[model samples]
Target: MNLLFLTFTFPLIGWLLLSFSRGKWSENLSALIGVGSVGLSALTTAFLIYQFNVNPPEGGVYTQVLWQWMSVDGFAPSFTLYLDGLSLTMLGVVTGVGFLIHLFASWYMRGEDGYSRFFSYTNLFITSMLFLVLGDNLLFLYFGWEGVGLCSYLLIGFYYSNRNNGNAALKAFIVTRIGDVFMAIGLFLLFQHLGTLNIQELMVLAPQKLVAGDTWLWWATLMLLGGAVGKSAQLPLQTWLADAMAGPTPVSALIHAATMVTAGVYLIARTHGLFLLTPEILELVGIVGAVTLVLAGFAALVQTDIKRILAYSTMSQIGYMFLALGVGAWDAAIFHLMTHAFFKALLFLASGAVIVACHHEQNIFKMGGLWKKLPLAYASFIVGGAALAALPFVTAGFYSKDEILWEAFASGHTGLLYAGLVGAFMTSLYTFRLIFIAFHGEAKTEAHAGHGISHWLPLGVLIVLSTFIGALISPPLAGVLPESFGHAGGEAKHSLELSSGLIAIAGIALAAVLFLGKRRFVSAVANSGPGKLLSAWWFAAWGFDWLYDKIFVQPYLLITRLLGNDPINSSIGLIPRLVRLGNSLMSRTETGNLRWYSASVAGGAVLLLALLLILN
Candidate 1:
């Protein structure tokens, strides 16, 4: 129990050592400190898990208050850590998957500039993510939330020599900041009405204070959903994620798999009680997820950049999680979150190896016939891709995603259920499309697979986890979250699972038909008029960036251009301008005209005398 705090401490110590070294340390030394710290954190988590299971805490909830912040009118939010089944599951994902990503990064970032600096940012990212999932109160959680945002900006722009990387970093920072503001407002609303930011206390108090669908409660939930949508890259806020791949492949894996993108799912699940009070907002959550999954799925189909396809896939998968959350399948949502961390991290790392092998060639159309050269990478992709496509009972994604779809169907959210089905098909199609095109076609470039132990070890481990073994490890959420309507639909559950599985298999078959040996048919269609239009549209992510430029960015640039001279400052300067004008006119009276001055004095004296006589 006492060791729970060590999870955060180890990562902090790593960041401090790497950061203070200022890139003076040797690569091996820097990697030791960086990877060792997260390794220690992962070890601590394992021990804590053992302790937690062997000796369960009272009510399966353990709260460790480190200290009080300040006292004011019955408001003293302490720096506390909360652990339960839900947090424990999230903790495992952050530290366990985080350690793997860090390990792989040490290999992936070899010979790169600012290697120590990269480790520093990644270590700090792990620390922030730990705090995000473990914090006991909303205030503490927000503290971690902002920290994760800052670390992402730093890591995404790690290759700052490129102007576009910096822009990508800044874009991610600003877009997520919009969501942070809404989350902050939501926290304030919760505190104002409930008088506490402690998550457990709020859960107990909210039902007592506000009835179902109370206006204040509804707005609070709505504000929280706004935060979730932005952070998770749903709908309008999703544009930053694809560009975010401008960073290192490890950063992409960290963001997409382990850290920044999953924060929203954790936030919503943590505050499930509040969302439950507002069914309308809850329904909106499902609707947002459904729309985002369908849109991102189509966009992924046409993306040629390997990393961008995975980026869109992350968005779509998270959309499924959100849809699960909206339909009241809390456990199912988190179950998929865990499984996703396993397979998605594997895909990114495997893609990183491929990218490095082909001399950093990222365009899928440019690479081919490397399956024999990079056997490990090819195998990694097959396992990870199968899991991603949720290929029936053999992969981790199948069990978790199947649970989500079944819950949606059982909950009577037929629209959401169908959306999940479509997303499943698209996921399989694009995943295999990348796999077949990149690994099986005519060779277009020379390749050398990464051979070091650091490079292959992480991939080997993640490849195993992406299989059915990973799916068997269910999170201990029996009492932590609301139970899904599991096993209630009887034979219908079997039918839905079988249908989703077959749909996924069909997508793979179609991808093979279209992308494999696709010199003629697919190319011909892509060149045709309507095909060109649709391909271009999907390639640009359905023109969200263009639409946003027209609606927001262009107008904003125009407004700034019009105000380039500081018109507000000029308007406020009017008072001083008028005063200066008066002073200029008054100065003329003192302009060395003695006769005029004497006449003015005589007029002033005569007026005073008349006033005095009238008063008398």
Candidate 2:
């Protein structure tokens, strides 16, 4: 309990050592440092959780103040750790799942260049995420937020030799920054009006100071939602996540599963109090989630690359979490976040194995009948996919996702409830579609699955967690978060769950019908005029990328090209240009020709004298 700081210290040290090693270290040494650091952090978190459960903290919260960060005229914020059920949950996910991802990366990235550098960035990402969750004040949280963003840029572009990878990293950084700036402004607004960035203080003061739907509260929450929208990869700002697949598979798992993408969901849940006061903004959160989930689900259905399919699935799952937040199912949101980490990470790591086994082929259509070759990966995908599709009773996703649907239904947000159901069907359909097409058809490529304790161990653990066992490990959010608003018991809840389960099963069956055999029917439809148009549209992620490219990227590039010479700087350069010209002319006049020099001096004197005479 007293050594809560150790959790952060371990990962921070790992990042530093790995970073300064300069890639000169042995791969084994790098693996040990990277995996060991997060392992220690995870161990520390587990111990802390044990202590917390044994003897709960006062007020269900504990604040560990390390130092006074700054003080000015009655404003003071400390580098403090806030321990509660929420942060504890997030801490467990970041360190626990993060450690697994790191362990698996050691196997996946073997013989790859910059192996040590990859771990360094991931280590820093974990450290920053820990601080983001545990920070007691908004300022401290924002510091960690920016740190995570920086580490993401580094890790996403880990293969900097590839221009596409660099561009993906840049896209992620820039898009998320747009949201971060909005969040920064929101923080400033809160501090300006409320006079403090302390989250606990703001929570208490905000209700006392502002009424429901207050203008100030509304704008501030909306701005914060902007940050959440971008970080979570929700609509309008979601184009970068698919492109982010340019990084290694382990990097994809870390970002999409336990760390970066989940940050926005955590942010909103952490700041739920602010949003509650702004009902419209709170509802808008649901609307955004609903829209993004449906859009992403459609997009995922058409994706061929194993990783991109998972990437879009990540976006869609995150939308579910956001919908939970928006509908005031705070506990449900965090619960789903935890379960999502388990299954999504499993899916990604398994995909990594499949990619490696299939000689780096990513298109699902390109690799087929791999279930026999890579039994572990096939089992991983089946289990993870079952959870992702929310298969009834046996899968973790069933429990968490059903809760969201019930909450939305009970909250009387019928529209969102319908959207969630539609997304669920799509999830089941595409998840199985990928599995059936890739694992069942005749082998299109030779594949020899890799073997090692590092690979099997992570997949094995995650496969278990993706089952009902994961759902049983509940988040300790009772006192930490507000009670969820939409709780319905008896037949209504059961019926909703039943319907959702049926919907999921129906989707899986439909997928088998379409893709299990020769894939002739699916192919025919895909090649048809309407189907082709729709497939192309959805394959392009509903043209958000294309639209953004045309509306934002291309126009911005055009402006940049137009200003390639830097017209403003060129205009500013004119003064120096004229001065240089005059100097050049004067220099020519002073060519050491004594007659020319004398004539110029005499002419200047005559002109001066004439001017003086005219003035007199």
Candidate 3:
């Protein structure tokens, strides 16, 4: 079975069919195609996994090239798929979580206009992301990378009639493009020095050609990191995600779960060799992850919009994955990435159900006492929240999150460890903050339920995975990741685990006190001066939007406004006009009359004679 070809082809075929559906595809059939494409791909991935286990790679890598994609100047890149432990792991996550999200979307988008269009974008994203992970070359991966971005813009701006939704999608597209620029530069540099963009060859040659701490190596990895930070919504590029909440809830789930947002982690992990040469940038990765998580946690706390709250949460959890990578815990990060996909998708889908029940009211502050009414959503949210908060040993998130902290501490970054603990606390605090206010207390308004097997089944599957997959998957992950990549140091500590567990409990207790009961305190604090300041800062994603406005936006706008009439260009453009004038004068000599031509020739000869006589 050509699993790689089939895996991506299924989704691409689905997207192509729906793109030209032209109202021929009914809502039900459109949903079937969208979900079925990914379902087929997921089955293929499982079969590949089974085959790989039965006949492991002799050299720990398996690659197949369907054909040569391009060849120029001795630079050849093939249409190839590379499968290893890493790509296989990502395949499972993308296809599995992706199918579940599509399943939920079928129910969530029922009767809505553009239902077919929504699934089209969803399948396209799946195809692009699959290409990203499975591609054998950097250019191919980059193609898939930008492909996902385009799909993200389309999906996030699906309701393009709304100004806010349009702007949010544009923001996401533009900000990530900034990082793409850096990544493109890095790719150029790599090709210049190493003469290849084939990912496996580049990995092998980069270390062979470039020494550790080489200047070019440092800059190249840093440039690549810029791209990763953008895609993953790490520090400095995270502002767009909160606003991305303006999209529908299914899009949010897809973004956070299986597609675009996770690409950065996959990129860094796939190119782990290049990163190893620049140790400083590697540590920087950890620092960025550690700090970003805390800031994102803080942002999550102040967000009234439920989707925005989850948006911030997604950023923070991805931070943990970054921290793991920085600490040389590659498997740990991927494990977290895997577990995160299941639970985060579950949380977002369940939240979608909540939004549906409330008739599209997104502000958790306006929702109350919905637990009994939306029992399935309530239960799913609880399961997802536990995983998000990493509730002790029971949840999948605990295993992944704990490994990162242990590695951070053992690796001698105690400060990062402490910061991670604080982030964990805030994660719990905000998660329950939404849960208590939205699902508890007096009813704010009537919320009609949207019932379906489609809705509940996906939630149930994800809930089970989030609850048990962590513990089950943890032991085997050590073997799945190749020995060459990396491993975290030191033995696991019961004390450290206990301390982290206690912190999570403390956060839950604090949230219950602060937000449970009357919840008037929530408002009172916000209305206070200090609270107002914190709320404002967090609401604005720590003023990154404002800071970028002052630093980049305002200046660009000023320049464009001053140049609106384009005077400088007009002046430069005058050279062409002057040339035209000179042409007109010259054309006078050839005025279609022999007498005029002769007279002009005589005049030129006389002028030349006069110049010669003066010189004499």
C-alpha lDDT (0 to 100) for residue 507 of candidate 3: 91
Off by over 4 Å in 2: 486-488, 561-571, 594-612
lDDT of each: 0.93, 0.94, 0.88
Could you tell me which residue pairs clash in candidate 1? none
TM-score of decoy 2: 0.97
**Candidate 1 lDDT tens digits, 452-563:** 8889899999998999999989798888887767657678899999999999999999999998985588899999999999999999999998998899999999989888
Compared with the true structure, what per-residue lDDT tens digits does model 3 show for residues 1-616?
Answer: 3556999999999999999997577888998898999899999988988887788776657888888988898998987998888888888889988998999899999988899999989999999998899899999999999998998899889999989889999999999999899999889888989999888788889889999998988888999999999999998788778888877788999999888888999899888889988989999999999999999999899888999899999999999999888877788788889999989999999999999889889989899999988888899888899899989988999988887888787778888899899999999999999999999998897887777788888998999999866457642344434442224343356778888999998898999999988867877988999999989998888898989999999999999998987988889989999999999998776669888888888999999999999999
Model 2, span 314-408: residue lDDT tens:
99999999999989999999999999999999999999999999989999999989999999999999999999999999999999999999999
lDDT of 3 at 406: 82
Instruction: Name the lDDT value of residue 264 in candidate 2.
Output: 93
Top-TM-score candidate index? 2
Residue runs of model 1 more than 4 Å from their true location after superposition: 566-568, 571-616
The TM-score values for the models, in the order shown, are 0.93, 0.97, 0.91
Q: What is the lDDT of residue 356 in candidate 1?
A: 93
